[model samples]
Target: MASINQLTFIKPKQFEWHEVPAPTLQNDGEAIVKPLAVTRCDLDLYMASGMYPMQGPFAFGHEIAGEVVEVGDGVKGFAPGDRVIVPFQINCGACDNCRRGFTNACTSVEPFAAYGFAPTGERKWGGGLSDLVNVPFADAMLVKIPDAVSITGAAAISDNAGDGYRTVAEPLKQRPGADILIVAGLAQSVGLFSVQAARALGAGRIVYRDYDAGRLAKAKALGAEVIETQYSPDLRATEEFPIVVEAAGLPDALTFAIRSTQPCGICSGVSAGMSNQAKVPLRSMYMKGITYTIGRVHARTEIDHLLDCAHCGTINPDDVITRSVPFSQAADAMMDPDIKIVFERD
Candidate 1:
């Protein structure tokens, strides 16, 4: 068996490069990939900081754009050397939910089967920050990176960027030129990417709120009207928007977003870490007839449209990356305060 080095999260605020057996094709439909550009998701910070409450000693990092190294005989549309974005979720395309484009709820694998996280599945699929990884459903889960998107820019297209698209793209299509409000702080990249997606998809005006000066500046640079304010449950939008996004993973932000939606409007909550005891503004939501959605992103379904926008220059997710480090420095870089970071390999 061949061995390779993988970044492992041994404990909170600690990481190590551990030697692990290289992945091999277990079936004809599988493929092996060598990640070239791997990006960190906002959840990584929570997980590594011990806020997410997940056990460690598992491979870390997942957002990936990689070169295919080997493919099984059954693999067709891809070959060795092909560059692809690996979705964080493990999905068999033919499953009922996957066929309906709900790839996140794929039934063929265990619930929430995914790479990087230790609890996602029984067998580790390995993390993107590794010498190699196994793609059990390559044809279903891997998307070829378009020529217009560089490898670095394509990294988060597999997850964060796609999650942002899910927030506003379809809603904007329903109500073109409608103004949008994004309440952001916790999920930093996803919030900024939401601004980028809204701009690319024809949203008329975007108002982004965050306490961080750097993030507020980035949101402003992305063509959003910026509002800098501390997180307060009392914070409320003076005016309702047809589309509202709550990326801050707090009950207060979520409630504020619900109250900020226009009548019959949609509020997309991208945060998943809010307390279970958080209260929903049931009376307000009911009276306003608003639609509130919160869950994991269906990345495989959203990446295609996101890549099209990227190809057309309507959005460049590369701007979301605040720091870039060599693959060798991934373990140390994880402890930094950068809003977004990518590890690159030659």
Candidate 2:
């Protein structure tokens, strides 16, 4: 039996690195991966603290830039000793959804086939923080990390960073040459990702509103004008925007995004923790003709464009990673107060 150390939950809000069965090739198309760099999600905090749902034998994490160690006979486009980024979502490329380029909603895998945080399919696949992970559809899901981009930096693209690119790319199609407004927060680092994505997508202008002074400074460093909305919840710029990205998954943040959007504008929210039941201004949204899009992302679909941005130094998610710890220290790294943590070896 192939077993290795992986992070698993012993109790709610607690984790430890324990040796478990390393991921095996369950199918002919499967591949085994060893994470060179992995990260914790903002949602992981909620799951760890029992704020969200939980079940037995909880596995943690999904963001990773990993090295391929083994490939099955059917695997294509990858082999042993190749560096790659494993998307947080599990997808089979030949499925109907994937054939149409919507890999996030692929049907070959069970619906909501994703890794980590007490979600379903725990027994079927391993999490990103594990010493080894089994990838079911290697050709479809695995994206090569560009030569110029460091593995640590590429780790973020497995989820947060790639979603950031999609967050703006979806809206830009509707309103070309328009500006974008991002209501960002610490949830999942999507906030900072929005700032980075908007700039790379060639928005006419970008404005980031966040309560965190430090995050605001980081936004400025990313070439976005900043609005410090800490003490003032009702505050907003007088001018509205054509594309508004609500990356902050906080209560009333959606309301604010809807209110601040220009009439007939597009507002896309990246936060998954949003309440299905809440005080949403539906009437206002209808009256303004706002188009609101929210849900999980197809990280692999948007990875190529992000790869270009990273290779040329257009954006640096590594700078946003405030903490770097060894893989043995990953469980402890989750307790960090920093914006982001990347687990790597010395």
Candidate 3:
């Protein structure tokens, strides 16, 4: 077995370099991949903050874009050296949920076990942050990376970008051309994607509110109308946007989003905030007839549409990636707030 290097979060505020055996074909349908690029999810912060119910000494991270290094004998439709993006959520395409277009919720794997969490397959294969990873049900889980997309750019799309697209675009099918309000955090990737996704959905107007000036600047550069923190106290007075997206991972932001949305409007809560309980104004939401949708993303349903938008130049998600760091520095890069960081091996 070949030795591989990996980053492990042994405890909160602690990370150590460890030498582990490289992953090999564990099943006839599995594939081994060398990550071309990887990234940290906002939920990682929750785990580090001791807010999430995650066990320690586990591999962390989910978003990955990589080159296929090896494929098991049973695998078809993919070959070695193919570049692909591994979505954080794994699924078997043959399952009923997957056939119904819910790949993220596939029944073959343990509930919510992807990269950065516990092992779901035969081996304890971790996320893309490692030198090599084993992807179970490879034929169903991998998507070929487009030639036009850079590895760093494609990395973001695997998770947050896809998430932002699903949160707004999927809901918009039921409510088209509705105004959008995104209450996001400046420190995370979701805010940046929210800015781009809203525009691609033909939103009548997009309003973004964040505490970070740097993020607000980026949002403005992306053509989103910026609402600074000073205006947050009176977010309800600005305008009644029918669609609201809560990506900040903060409970307060969710509350604000619920209050700002109009009656019969939809508020998509995409944050994985550690808090189990949220204080919502039930009376207000009930009286105003507001609707709320929350939980993990459904990216497979929207990836094709998002790719079409990207191919036609209707959306440019690459703009949200502010920095690309080498895989060695990913740990430090994630701690920095100045830029949205993407990790590349080469």
Q: State the lDDT of candidate 3 residue by residue for 161-186, as single tens digits.
A: 88888778866778888778888773
Tens digit per residue, CA lDDT, model 2, 252-289: 67678888899899999786553556566789889999
Query: Could you tell me which 10 consecutive residues in candidate 1 have the lowest summed lDDT?
Result: 271-280
Clash-forming residue pairs, model 1: none
Cα lDDT, model 2, residue 97? 81
TM-score of every prediction relative to native = 0.98, 0.93, 0.93
Model 3 residue runs over 4 Å out of place are: 49-53, 119-123, 230-237
Compared with the true structure, the alpha-carbon lDDT of candidate 1 equals 0.90
lDDT (Cα, tens digit) per residue for candidate 1, span 196-288: 999988898899988899999999988999988676778776889999999988877888888889999999989765355678888989999
Candidate achieving the largest lDDT: 1
* Model 2 ranges with Cα > 4 A deviation: 231-237, 272-276
lDDT of 3: 0.76
Which order, best to worst by lDDT?
Answer: 1, 2, 3
Instruction: Judge candidate 2 at residue 12 and give its lDDT.
Output: 68
Worst 10 residues of 2 by lDDT: 229-238
Local distance difference test scores for all models:
0.90, 0.79, 0.76
